[model samples]
Target chain A: MSVELDIILSFKDKMFRLAHRITGSYEDAKDIVQESLIRLWKMADKIDKYANPEALAITITKNLSLDWIKSKNNRINKMQIEEYENVLVSKEFSPEKSIEINQLHEMILKLIDSLPAQQKIIFQLRDIEGLTNKEIAEILKVNENIVKINLSRARKKIRELLTKIYNYYEN
Target chain B: MKIEELIEKYFEAETTPEEENILKEYFTSANYDKKLEIYRQYFIFLNSERNIVPGNFLPASILNENSKSKTSFNILSYKWLAIAASFLIIFIIAFTYFKSNVNNAAIVITNENFNEFKDLGTEVTFDAFFKISEYMEYVKSSINDIQAVNETFQILQTYNLMNYQ
Candidate 1:
């Protein structure tokens, strides 16, 4: 394949992960990736007009993912928040000290999902996607400081809640 | 410096992504410190999530469409270039014709007597000189017509003399 196609394919999973994090639906994320690829393909000849094609692809995926959310008028439902809060403070410390690591991982994932949209996406880009603050800022069209601050907030919240869950088990 | 210190720095949101990657590697390794076990699952989850690729995506269709559009763009550009070249050629030919006409309009009369008239300063002299030149052209054409008629008369006289003989 051509160099442009190679570059685009290299970032396919990155775009997919970003979309999946933002929209929280595998199907919507896949659609967003498809749309992004089509757009990049159309501009393939002029792709160099973008200083960073990977960033351009991510920005398009982010915008389309947000559009999907806005069109559906959906936020993380109240039930999910209640579930998250209950998980954080539940007093059911089974003395059976052998809790599965997978369960803890699921709990952390839910806690991440419970964060505000901006903080959650910032955290996702930084931690799970392994992107730099500047890269996330460019993709989200925000200042680097804003990305850093939001990421800090996200990490603090998740760490605090996870600590609470661990404390409950300890007690 | 220590892994525990780095983990604390990470929670405080003071660690760079490179440092975080180190933490990730340490936690996901088989021999992470038992004291750091609390953060192990989170790191493993992040690693797993990062590894999650979308299923079976083939962009052959997109590449095909892209190639088609590229071909059409080249053709359109070539067509526009041809039109531009044709217009440039026409403009050059018309400009040369107009420039030659301007040069002919400014031709200087070259008679020796006219040199004396050149000292008669002011634009009026040049205007009068041009008028004189036009009149001279008319006189010259008239003389040529008279010469042609005289030749015809001579021929008629020769024929009359022959009949008399």
Candidate 2:
């Protein structure tokens, strides 16, 4: 149990980032990652056979996150990603500076959440989690070119949205 | 490379990780071109997103369950120990009870035998006393008869002398 738990904990942050990118909620991401680790723990014996356990864990988290979204949709009460951004915004902050910064972060998160799932994950993995395109492709089981294309689209869309907001504020 | 060139490369998603780092540094430093100020917030958000962790929300039940399993293992061992101790106690009690009953039975048998032997001795002594009394009476009767026979013999001698005179 110790060995398995340690192995799972090593991937905790990475798995959370992947899940968070998909689910757009810290709480949901935590649940998804926890479930992914549990599943990994169940297959601890065969996990060594996989060359990249991290990638396997990420894939598992990604699928569970998608499943979470599906189940939420089936319930007909899908939660807004902005609600989770509010949770992220409520953290300890200095009065004026922290509020503005948190709002900016929240707005950026909301914008990122608007991207399609593939583009969103690629952007998170590359720009935020700081993984190489090759690694992202490996984790996604897609080609490096696809990963690049999605990342480019994600960055362009976010930049386009930000420019609109900035110009509006300037006016 | 020029900051403008790096910014263009960044939006194009063609910047290397190092080049992106330089872009992030330039934007966050707030010394970049005024036109790039909008992108500064975006880069700042990215930098902040990197530090955002799930933070101690890894489901306490998992870790708690592990501890609970360890506790349950200890409890299982204690349960077996308690059962074994109970068995040992029962065995000792049963052995003591059997030994005491056997000793009591042996004592009762010895006492019953001693009482039977006393009753048989008393009966034999009474029979012997009765037999001795009967033998003494017979001897006395024979002595009397002998005395009578002597007197008769004297009388016969007196009668024969008178006839001769």
Highest DockQ model number: 1
State the displacement of the C-alpha of residue B22, model 2, in Å, after optimal TM-score superposition: 3.0
lDDT of 1 by residue, B61-107 (tens): 78576577668778889999999999999999999999989767653
lDDT of 2 by residue, A1-171 (tens): 466667777888888887887776777888888888778877776877888787788788888987887877522124444454444436533344333656666667777776677888899889988888998899888999999889998898777667655654555
Q: Model 1, stretches more than 4 Å misplaced?
A: A75-82, A88-97, B59-165
- What does DockQ come to for candidate 2? 0.31
Q: Which candidate is the best by TM-score?
A: 1
Residue A147, model 1: lDDT of 88
Task: Tell me chain A's TM-score in each of the predictions.
Answer: 0.88, 0.78
For model 1 the TM-score comes to: 0.65
Candidate 1: pairs in clash = none
Return the TM-score for chain B, candidate 2.
0.47
Top lDDT hit = 1
What range of 10 consecutive residues in model 1 chain B has the weakest lDDT sum? B113-122
